[model samples]
Target: MFCASLADVFDNSVDLAWRADLWALVRDTPHLDWLVLTKRIGNVSAMLPADWGCGYGNVWLGISVVSQDEADRDIPKLLCLPAAVRWLSLEPLLGSVSLQSATGPFGETLDWAVVGGESGPHARPMKAEWVHDLRAQCGTLAIAFFFKQWGGHENGK
Candidate 1:
């Protein structure tokens, strides 16, 4: 959790041997729970180690989503994979999103979701109503909701 927050381990841009060494580190670090959050989630299945029988016990797989389009396109793929836990990050929320269609074709839903606005001089603004709506939806669906922040240009707004 304390390591690279923005670097996706499944990224194919990196060297295979480097990825292997990283996975090896994750495998050997039995005391730490590794959270691999990525936007390149489509490459996840191919990036997994051969020994990932049913996925590692300490690893959590999550996808980054900025809007409904990404969520709709990625969540289904995420559900098909095996993992200790699955989640979504709505950080730097760019637009409103509805999770109603994000469920399984049957009725499955995600395990966790995080919501936060953008921050920085160049950051775009977000609506508080959007975050509230997401919280309500998570409540109704029993998905864990972690409200990270109400971002602004300065301070933790």
Candidate 2:
């Protein structure tokens, strides 16, 4: 399940009690694997539940990155957290990104990468080379790569 798809679970504006309630819901639903994607990677370490030691088994924590700068700044933070699965959402990929430099405790501990171009009315064009390079990097690193869609007025390659 995609947890908080329209809103960020780690956003500072979110009420503490509400976040607790959400954590309770997540704890109760052990059968479902929750994919929690957030752009606020820096806020996660402090906002996580008190009992989130080594992270929950059913939770897959992911960080969203649109370019190399964001990736470089956030991937390391995401890798530091102990999650059952650590992944990246490269949606609206605005520029080329090289993940080869992102090393963590267990080397590059990223388990998966969901890549795609920008979408919507004002979406910018995503170069085919950028996507291909990312895919190749993921292949070399043994990270699962998923190509979601090509952005901007068109679909597919």
Candidate 3:
């Protein structure tokens, strides 16, 4: 699995490999049967190739929409990617977000979604309503949803 930042590079820090690295790795060796993308919201402005990482059925690209703000910004980018399977990562759900408000690119390409609350010190809050809305949206769109864990401080209790 590749983290979001690894896929999109900005600010001219040229040490890491490009998105094609994923494609190359997968093409060279399809040993990777499952891949999960993390923190995808961090890459709103970066340029990704049209083929985008890997299109193999075994790979899954997921974007983390931490809040409504991230949902608006990053979801579009993730939707536009050429990956075969696209998904959303709503971990650390801090604020309200609506899949109904999502645009065409998002509503169409998304294949799955995961929802969960924040955890650890200074953990943020998540309303059950928010998760319900996300779940409803996923169901409406026929997308799969996964809820990880609520924040350890509040919801976990």
Best by lDDT: 2
In model 2, the runs with Cα more than 4 Å from the true position are 106-108, 153-157
TM-score of 1: 0.89
Model 3 per-residue lDDT tens digits across residues 91-155 = 87887787754445435457888788887777777888788888888888788888887775455
Please list the residue runs of candidate 1 whose C-alpha ends up more than 4 Å from where it truly belongs after superposition: 105-108, 153-157
Clashing pairs in 2: none
Question: lDDT (CA) for every model shown?
Answer: 0.82, 0.91, 0.66
**C-alpha-based local distance difference test score of model 2:** 0.91
Please give, for residues 1-157, the per-residue lDDT of candidate 1 as tens digits.
6345958777778789988998899899978888788898889999999998767888878888999899888989887777777788998888888887657654556889988878788887777778888989899988899989778733333
Q: What TM-score does candidate 3 get on C-alpha atoms?
A: 0.73
Query: What residue pairs clash in candidate 3, if any at all?
Result: none
**TM-score per candidate:** 0.89, 0.95, 0.73
**Model 3: residue 93 alpha-carbon error in angstroms:** 0.3
Candidate 2, residues 75-117, lDDT tens digits: the string is 9999988889999999988889999656796764899999998
* Residue 1 error, candidate 1, Å: 1.6
Ranking by lDDT, best first?
Answer: 2, 1, 3
**Model 3: lDDT of residue 156:** 36
